[model samples]
Target: MTHTILGANGTIATELIPVLKKHNVNIRLVSRTPQHVEGTESITADALDSEQLLSAILGSDVVYLTIGLVYNAKIWEEQWPVIMRNVINACKTTGAKLVFFDNIYMYGKVDGIITEETPYNYISKKGKVRAELAKMLLKEMASGNIEATIARAADFFGPRATEKSIPSVLVFEKLKAGSTAQWLINPNVPRSLNYTPDIAEALYILATNEKAFGQVWHLPTPAPLTGKEFVKLAAKHLKSSDKISVLPKWLLKIIGLLNPFMKEAYEMNYQNEFPLHLSSAKFEKAFAFKPTSYEDAVKETALWHLNR
Candidate 1:
């Protein structure tokens, strides 16, 4: 059966497409300027185009919504709703189940642990946007117009992730250059950081498992480590014991003066500057699954960096 993946070139999709192919899924990709990857089908279509989205979703058994407004806040507010509207309409029309790749921003600040049941407590614009989209999908499902499931992952980090998030420029690039790894630096705190491939696996599980629809599931995420501890682990794999450092908060604010992106980053100090943890007990018990150990995952990540 066919499964369409939106945002064809994203980090999770890069791993997801290949894994889906291994399971004999007829993988189709939707992108603005799609390029055919060998052994997969491609369709160049914007999510905002209802006609295009319908065409992309036609005859697909499952569609993965990996699409999101990437780096620009203004463009995101203007674009995401239109894109989601198209997806909802297409799925409603064609009856294809949707497996949405979602992040943790909607959960916002939690003093203890973030579980699947956590309320959407964040007041941020982006957090509210995610909360609404999720609520709409579930609401639609309740009316029997659509079948959908969501796989929630923490800050994604793995090979091919670039400058946009923590794992890329902040972690991999710094370590590769033998520098004191830079981050927001909250040692002794804990939070989950999911591997993209593991998230893909969970998404695939949701796509194929009829029992998984109409609900959201957590991805199997390894227990969180402090920023300093995580860097040390990765460095240990590379035969280095470099101490981790943080870009001073004052420095981050100064940079935010010129960079709107940094301005957004400044608000997310909770993830790295203090205690934040995401619990994955539900996914583990549901699938009898376990995440790769933090030490092992770190070693693999470091090896990827060194090999690159």
Candidate 2:
């Protein structure tokens, strides 16, 4: 079987490549500037360009869309739909199954635990873009135009995800550097975070299992932990101080005024203010998979940052 990754070299895709290699499948990496991995074919292609995307996906048995665009609402609104449409069309034309790596932004401000059945009620521009892309994919699946599955994850942290993960930046990296760790909004609310390696393994399982198609699956995640708890755990592992500074919403708003990334992040601050719990019971039960605990995850993440 030939497995193609549309956005290679990102944190998730980087971790996923080795898992696919273990299964002895032909691996094809595609991106605008893809890095060459020994024993795998690497092709450079822009996902926003339909012709390029289709050519890169040709002859693949399965395709995984793991692309993450720049953190800007305007960019997301303009490019996300186009990328999703191009990938869906490419998969349709190639007769290849698709596995979409997705986030939980579409389930904005959930009053309770987030599940696959949770309704879409996005509150941010980025979330709206995600909702539309999800709807687009579901529409194609409903019409039987393609075989696909959506693997959604909460904010993730693990090796190679420091650039994209909030906790990796605020907690692990800060602690590693002997600096004050930070948490956004409230430190009391519980938040669910998936380990990157676990996500990679679950994606591989979803891609290989025929029965996993035509559905949305939440990748296995451990029980939620409060921001304070997360920071303390990471600090303990890193042998650093556990002191944490909470970045209030007002402060974030002020920072957003000057920092474009913070400005984009401001709208999603509700996630930190509320209990961000995600339930992967369906996936865990179906695959008999267990997620790595926060204690171990924090230790490994801290070590990675420290050794680097």
Cα-based lDDT for every prediction: 0.81, 0.94
In candidate 2, which residue pairs get closer than 3 Å at backbone N, Cα or C atoms, i.e. clash?
Answer: none
Which candidate gets the maximum TM-score versus the true structure? 2
Minimum summed lDDT over a 10-residue window in model 1 is located at: 159-168
Error of 2 at 175 (Å): 0.8
Tens-place lDDT per residue, model 1, 180-273, is: 6777646557767888768788889889988888888889887787777777787788776567776777888999899888887676666666
With a 3 Å backbone cut-off (N, CA, C), the pairs that clash in candidate 1 are none
Model 1 whole-model lDDT (C-alpha atoms): 0.81
**What is the overall TM-score of model 2 with all chains considered together?**
0.98
Q: Give all TM-scores, in the order shown.
A: 0.95, 0.98
Where model 1 places Cα greater than 4 Å from the true spot, the runs are none
RMSD of 1: 1.4
Residues 95-203 of candidate 2 have per-residue lDDT tens digits of 9999999999998899998999999999998899999999999999999999999999988999888779999899888888889999999999999999999999999
